[model samples]
Each structure stands twice: as structure tokens, then as C-alpha cells.
Target: MKILTLHGINLNMFGKRDPKQYGTATLAQIDDQLRALGQELGAEVECFQTNFEGEMAERIHRAHTDGTDAVIINAGAWTHYSYGLRDALAILKCPIIEVHMSNIHAREAFRHVSVIAEIARGQIAGFGVDSYLLGLRAAVSAVQQG
Candidate 1:
């Protein structure tokens, strides 16, 4: 199975941004962990990170034609208001799993809302990097079940 992982905006600063919520794992390290877990899950994981909203939307467009079986996304602040990204994801026929390192609901009031949640197959959060892994597993399971 082919799985695409999308990391958005400011997430490139995973390690240096804020150790309190994001932890010390660099984006590269997080990608490595996802790839390793994907291998064990018998899925090929392709990761993409972009600080630009247009680029992310474009990538989602590509995933539509790329035959991606599932998608795991952590869209950072964009998760709250990026209708463009959500619309792009809506074009996909595969399962979409949203993830967050921190519990967005437990954070600021603005962070409590997710525009992507309505379109996503499900969501995982509050367990740091484990959220990504769980999201991946959820995506794979959803694909298999279908």
C-alpha cells in the first residue's frame, strides 16, 4: 500500500520550535520513524512537508493521481482554517487520517477547531509522535477493511 504523510506550515521547526508541546524530534527524525513503521506495516510511506499552503494543496492534487492508498496529515495551524487543503484532500478517494502531536482541544480556544476533521476519516492526537504512528495504522486499517 502507498501512504502519503503530509506535514504542514511551521512543523519544519519540530525540534527547535517548542520542546514543551512538539518535543525535540526533528522533522527528519519523525519522518524516519514513520517510514520505519510503514515498512513494518507493509506500506510504502512517502512524506512531504511544506510551509506553503499552495504547495501543500498541489501535493494533495498529485496524491489524487499518484494512486495513494491512504493519507496521514498534521496540518499545524492550517488544520483550523485551510479550506484549500481540505478541499484538495476531498479530491482523494482514500482514507484521510488527521493527526496532532499536542492535544489541540486541550490547548488554546482557537486550536480546538479543525476544519479538516469533517472531511477526514478520523483523527488522532495528544500522544506526541505516537499520534502519527496511530494515524498511519488507522489509515492502513481503513484501507484494508474497505
Candidate 2:
């Protein structure tokens, strides 16, 4: 299976930003772990990160035609208010799992809502980098079941 992992906004600042909320793992470290885990699950994983919403949307468009089997996304702050990204993801027929390193619900009021949740197959959050891993596993499992 082929899976695409999308990391948006300030995610590249993972290890440097708020260690109390996000773990010390750098973005590259997180991606490497996801890729390694993907291999263990017999899936091909491709990861993309960007601070630009438009670029992220364009990447999602490319995935639509790129034969991507599923998607695991941790759209950072975009999760709270990026309809463009949500609509871009809506175009995909494959399953999508929205993930969050920190638990949005337990954070400030502004972080509690997600623009992508309604379109996603499901969501995983609050488990640090493990949330991404679980999202990948869920997406792959969903794809296999279908």
C-alpha cells in the first residue's frame, strides 16, 4: 500500500517548539520513524511538510492522481481553520486519518475544533508522534479491510 503523510504549518518546529506539548523529536525524526513503521506494515510511506497552506493543498491534489492508497495528516494549526485543505482532502476517495501530536481538546478553546475531522475517516490525537503512527496504522488497516 502507498500512504502519504502530510504535516502542515509549524510542524517543522516540532523539537524546538513547546516541548511540554510536543515531544523532543524533530520533524525529520518523526517522518523517519513513520517511514520505518510503514515498512514494517508493508506499506510505502511518503511524507511532506510545508508552512504554506496552498502548497499543502497542491500536494493533496497531486496525491489524488498519484495512486495514493491512503493519507495520514497532522495539519497543525490548519486543523482548526483550513477549509481549503479540508476541501482538497475531500477530493480523495481513499481513507484519511487526521492526527495531532497534542490533544486539541485539552488545549485552549481555539484548538478544540477541527476543520478536517468531518471529512476524515477518523482522527487520532494526544499521543505525540505515536498519534501519527496510529493514524498510519489505522489508514493502512482501513485500506486493507476495504
Candidate 3:
């Protein structure tokens, strides 16, 4: 199965943004780990990240054309209010999983709402990098079961 893992907005600055929250892992490091985990789970993983909302939406559209079997997205701040991204994800036929390194619910009130949650098959948060890993495992399992 092919799983597209998307990181959004300021996520590229993960390691430098806030050590208290995102930990010290760079975006590359996180993707590399997810790829390794994906291999063990028998799924091919492709990762993408962009600060631009339009570009993120475009990538989601491309994933549809590319025949991606599942998607795991951590849309950063966009997770709270980007209806456009949510719409793009809604277009996908495969399972969509939303993940976050920090617990949005435990943060500021603005961070508590997720526009993507309505369309996603599941949401995993507050477990740091493990959230992404779990999201990947969930996507793979969903595809295999389907």
C-alpha cells in the first residue's frame, strides 16, 4: 500500500520551533523514521510538506491522481481552520488520518478545533512522533483490510 504523509505550515521548523513541544527531531528525521516503520509494515510511504496552504491542497489533489491508498496529514495551524485543506482531503476516496505531535486539545482554545477531523477516518495526537507512527499503522491496516 502507498501512504502519503503530509506535514504542514511551520512544521518544517519542527526541531527548532519549540523544543518543549515538538522535540528535537527535524522534519527529515521524522519522515525517515516513518519510512522505516512503513517498510516494516509492508507499505510504501511518501512524505510532503509545504507552508503554503494552496500548495498543500494541490499536493492532496495530486495524491488522488497518483493513486495513493491512504493519507496521514499533520496540517499544523491549518488543522484548526483551513477549510480548503479539509475540502481537498474530503475528495479522497481512501482513508484519511490526522496526527499531531502536541496535543491540540491541551493547548490554546484556538488549537482545539480541527477542520480536518470531520473528514478523517481517525485522529491521533499528543504522543509526539508516535502519533505519526500510529497514524501510519492505522492507514496501512485500513488499506489492507479494505
| Residues 43-80, model 3: lDDT tens digits | 99999999999999999999988989999999999999
In model 3, pairs of residues that clash are none
Worst 10 residues of 1 by lDDT: 82-91
Clashes of each: 0, 0, 0
lDDT of each: 0.95, 0.96, 0.95
TM-score of each: 0.98, 0.99, 0.98
**Which regions of candidate 2 are displaced past 4 Å?**
none
The reply for model 3, stretches above 4 Å from the true place, is none
- Give the lowest summed-lDDT range of ten residues in model 2: 77-86
Winner by lDDT between candidate 2 and candidate 1: 2
lDDT value, candidate 1, whole model: 0.95
RMSD in angstroms between candidate 3 and the native structure over all alpha carbons = 0.6
Model 2: lDDT equals 0.96
Q: Clashing residue pairs, candidate 1?
A: none
